[model samples]
Target: MRLTPDEGDLTARAFARLDARLTRDTGRPVALALSGGGDSIALLRLATEWARARGRSVLALTVDHGLNPESGGWTAFAAEAARAAGADWCGLSWDGDKPQTGLTAAARAARHGLIAQAAREAGARVVLFAQTADDIAEADLMRSEGSTLGRVREWSPSPAWPQGRGLMLLRPLLGERRAVLRDWLAGQGADWIEDPANVDPKFGRSRARQALAGAAPPAPEEARALAGGRPTMDGEAMVNVRRDIGARALAAALVCVGGGATPPRGARLQALTARLRAGENFAATLCGARIEAAGDAVRVMREAGDLGRRGTAPQVLTPGVEAVWDGRFTFRAEHPGWSVEAARGRLASLSDADRTEINRLPAATRGAWPVLIRDGALAPVLAGEGVERRALVAERLRLALDETTHEDDLISATR
Candidate 1:
């Protein structure tokens, strides 16, 4: 349903409140991912107003994924909209060759990477997305169809660090419907571009959206429940407080600790949960992560077998370009051709002091710990040795754990 004028004002006020909270936590300006779509354009407009009143900066970043012929024009249109809304604007492009298969997934990853990079360069720690209630409902429907996609949290730490650079993605419009946002824009005499892909039945999201036409939108309570609680993870284990959390949060934790891109199967996760509840000491592996039950807690660590199976292929680390090696650590070397590989076997070659220092980490993590090589010899660079390195997997685990562990505070703030 369309939003009334008063409802639109309330939505703007809600955006302002959410933006203020994020700014306070991150202590940085706001960065909006603009796409010239109704939801994003509305966000740009609202964010511009909010920032102006608070004397804060708002950057609008338009990422051209270069997938469609009209993507360039779309970027230009987004730029114009941002400028009209009194926000600083920048255009980013995904320049590399697109993958033939999984084009949508590749383009999405590229878009987020480019946007995160731009936001970091602009000194913004929080990137705002224009996802609305309608989108959330559609995603829920897709999940019900066994899509294996996770729910989008209102506040999420970037999964890929260095490239993401510790940026937080904030979806402030999750409580607002898309039609309401469009109506608000219409009232303001603003127009938005309707991407042709939105109606294409080949896209799963498009099909889901079509299926949602006569379906009742997700209830507010259900949406909040689906948003789930924050995660709590100790260095070695994730505390699974089942009643306070959901499968998606657990899956995210497993993926984060497992260092795998895809999450474990839902059935596998459920079985693990049952085992944990049964209070049986057991060990299982899924999604490249090893889960070991230990007295009411489940410890998640990188699977050694998976690491060994990855083979000793050293990835070339280029200067200024961030790369996540082995899905464990994000690193950018000062020089080119710096090959990053597992620290296994090579740890003995290290000096006594270096070995001692590296031993402080968990034994399971040591095998996958980043070790650099240059000219076929081990480089002296280590994680804390003035090197640009971010433990992405560990960071994700920690953040997700923290969020779930202290979910009450987060829920209270949202209320």
Candidate 2:
């Protein structure tokens, strides 16, 4: 694990490249998730130095999962390290009833959720993670062993969106090795905490690491070309093009419209794409989305049944706080005391014009549209003449599609 002077020089160059890419993608005021581990500590130092040189700011966030008694001390140490690097620091905790089973998965989700929330509150649009080459190799091994884990890309859209509104996740250190990073830290006379979970054989990741000993690190993946603008596809034209593009684009559309966390299964998606390519006209449902093919066009929308099953009860909207209703639309009110509920059953009360506008949307998705209530009367918030709000929703949907499309394209290219 020892690094020569040349390796150290290469690591520095890699850091510089990452800094430039991050600065170009996300401007001032970046956020870093610091865990008091060697990888994250190295990232904190590198990001702080880069931000200082560019006259920008960095927000260092540490999440205390509270699973271990020593987590509090780890957070304090992380905060101190951030301060030593001349960066602003914040600590968040995952406080709630701990699950009896699947503790690791639950904690990981909580950690990401808390980090995204904190970054949004701090007005940061991008958060950096410290996952390294070693982590990627281990993840690949886990997947080969039928773990069902997904690949971690270098640039990914935040999984916890709306709560993480306008946020992107960056793993700049994915190209660097863990040993090199720790060696770099040692050379700088810096210290980091060693979490016992890393070696607690009960964890699959720990077992993977031990199994990876003496194995050559996997070759670094070439950075994928992300679309600079929003992705658009004509369903009719897509079927005539590459099957990969058609399938990937279709998956992205379904996930975006359905507001699902992950895309549908690969085999099912591919089969659907094949059917569409054969010019079949039919309707079906998958991943909370209703897919309809008519004439030469295919359309996808949120499934009404799924919405009814999972929709949240009416909640009062507070001024300056945004809420995601029905997991499809993000609602924020400038005025207070407004309650948001599904537009279902209340559409009958609207004017003919409003009703027509509501009906223009896909039949399967009309039930999930957000409606405002005040004084016990329903009001059309997103229907008819509310062009600005409609445009905002469209923009968010486009962004989501862009992210999913980018990841899909990357995976296809790599395969």
Count: clashes, candidate 1:
7
Q: lDDT for every model?
A: 0.70, 0.69
Alpha-carbon deviation at 121 in model 2, angstroms: 1.2
* Cα lDDT tens digits for candidate 1, 106-197: 78878887888788777776778988778878889888887766677667655443466356677777777777777788877898999989
Instruction: Estimate the TM-score of every prediction.
Output: 0.79, 0.84
| Model 1: CA > 4 A from native | 1-11, 24-27, 159-162, 214-216, 219-249, 260-262, 294-297, 312-327, 330-340, 351-365, 372-394, 401-415
**lDDT of candidate model 2 versus the reference:** 0.69
Write down the RMSD of candidate 1 (Cα, Å): 5.4
Query: Could you say which candidate leads in TM-score?
Result: 2
Pairs of colliding residues, candidate 1: 230-403, 230-404, 231-401, 231-403, 231-404, 232-401, 233-401
